[model samples]
Target: MSKQNNYSYIGIAFIILVFGIIFVPRIIDRITKGDITRQESRSDYAEEKKAVDSKLSDLAFIESFGEKRKVPDFSFTNQHGKTITNKDFEGRVYVVEFFFTTCPTICPRMNVNLVKIQNEFKDFENFGVASFTINPDYDTPEVLKAYADNYGITNPNWHLMTGDKEAIYNLANKGFYIYAGENKDAEGGFEHSGNFALIDKNGFIRSRIEDGNPIVYYRGITSEDEQVNDEGEREQISILKEDIKKLLNE
Candidate 1:
């Protein structure tokens, strides 16, 4: 062989030798340490994937200042005439709303949507609803019971609650930050926020994060069939249902 050809062969061998010394060991070390992505076991891969998915899929906490907000303690009478308190919802995922049995406008729509939610998660024992009546004087346990029957609210955990009017208002306005009051000028002689607040198993209020902020409440006035209302607000009941499932799993 020519000396020039021999030189070229040496150069090629030197490059190969350098690569073996510098990079091959790193590749082997990564595999040995389980740092190589493709070398991961199926179960390990699944666990890592689950963790990442959990971070992405988990709902946001409704926070006040830097502290996470939670559903405040409350005591009210349910349709069964049993006293219901915040303790009753421990270790359960629930939705909260304010309504009156006599409402002629938005209350029916709200309850209908709530019934749909109730039916969707009927099989899950840990899922529930807390419907607080804004007009407690008119919505006694008997009246609330009849209203629940009329609406087909069959979820055993679904509670139609009524108690002191001022306390109910305080819970709605100051506690949950949801609006509820006697509005003589409004339809049905009362007004309330047409939004539902989601509470997790631990009583911490939860919601979907959007644009780096917690939406805090789902629009109860919109049906799943109505994707967006005349006011251009998109219906959130579907997302709410999915979130309830997520919380239930958590």
Candidate 2:
């Protein structure tokens, strides 16, 4: 029981503490995975975290472009001609998309997918769809009303909007960050992609899908003079449905 013995005891305790700190995680990992070390544990943790993050992602691929800010407010009208804006959705989850009625490639498919979702989410709460027509010049309130009816989208929750062309363009480019513009030769007043933007209740563009509009837009099969064809646009119906379900389920 001398000072030398006390010092020796303290040194052993410190070594044991360091050993546990270094090896406990590895030991636990080995017992679970059968062949992992501390490094492997760290790697596995990161990968698991990434996979989980990828599943319920609250991020969009557009973040890398230095444009991940919140979506801006703007005015538009639904199929019923009711006034609406991003501000109205400040407390609700919105699955937004950009399309023009004359698009022969993407709009039809996108509508069909949205219809499927509307049909599937009959009982979903607070979550809804907001499709902003790129061809504001032609997709007037009446045109959108008929369009929504044609697709059997009877849900009051769904909104097909058309407003000031320039403002819609701004929302497409600056707010939602999707493709939308005038195309004099494109059989419509404007054109846009089929990408669906999944926006959260907080006005954040959370995720994007690759599924384009339905093939219905490609009907008539005529390259003769001019027509709409969404075939070349991205197909994002599946992702749209999945993420919409996720947001509503939340």
Candidate 3:
């Protein structure tokens, strides 16, 4: 080979050696330490996604005597004066609460959290809320409509319902077992559980598992921003939101 050609070849060989000594080790080190993304990284990501899916899918169904506790049949007039029934909630994930428009305690906080939740899933057509008035006597369709508007509840699927007092109470106490009753001395002239129930697409009551038992209801009295309430109970609104998402996806 000519001198110039030999020198050109040598220069190219030296450059290759330099690249191998520097860049190659870094590239190899990155691969070894998992710092460089590879097909394995995508696999790892899929595994993580699967784990999340599993967590979301594990929401427990509230059961009684080995049979899943489905939402009891109900028919009530909504804020718009339209009759709503359990069938209306078919194929949707929803939250249920018992509150009177004039409740003096817990109801406001409960609804504030609910409205936050409503906003979170506002874009979801299959997500909704069912606010059954404990004081149906006072919460007529017009009254319920005013309450919904006052609270900025804009979700089209949401329904603030009122109906026959006896049926409403039975639905709350006997059907859902959520504890709604008349209490003459109670702050709002009535007492009801400040817990919210989550219903699945199939009308089955669903909840999260704690210690292998379904925690049948979520504490609606606590706000999502309050991690711990005055009773030192952890706020469940955030988890409720997550569970709602899970059910919605299902």
Q: lDDT of all predictions, in order shown?
A: 0.92, 0.70, 0.92
Rate residue 38 of model 2 by lDDT: 65
**Per-model RMSD to reference:** 10.4, 10.3, 13.1
lDDT of 2 at 82: 96
**Tens-digit per-residue lDDT, 18-56, candidate 1:** 999999999999777875555567768899989867754
* Best candidate, lDDT: 3
Clash-forming residue pairs, model 1: none
Tens-place lDDT per residue, model 3, 1-250, is 8999999999999999999999999989987777546777888999999987775567998888989899998999999999999999999999999999999998999999999999999889999999999998899999999999999999988999999999999999999999999999999899999999999999999999988788899999888677899989999999999899889877
Candidate 2 lDDT over residue span 85-175, tens digit each: 7787776666677887777775776677667767777776667778888877788989999998888987776889998888888888877
Which scores higher on TM-score, 2 or 3?
Answer: 3
- Runs off by more than 4 Å, candidate 2: 1-68, 208-235
Clashing pairs in 3: none
How close is every model to the real structure, measured as TM-score? 0.78, 0.61, 0.77
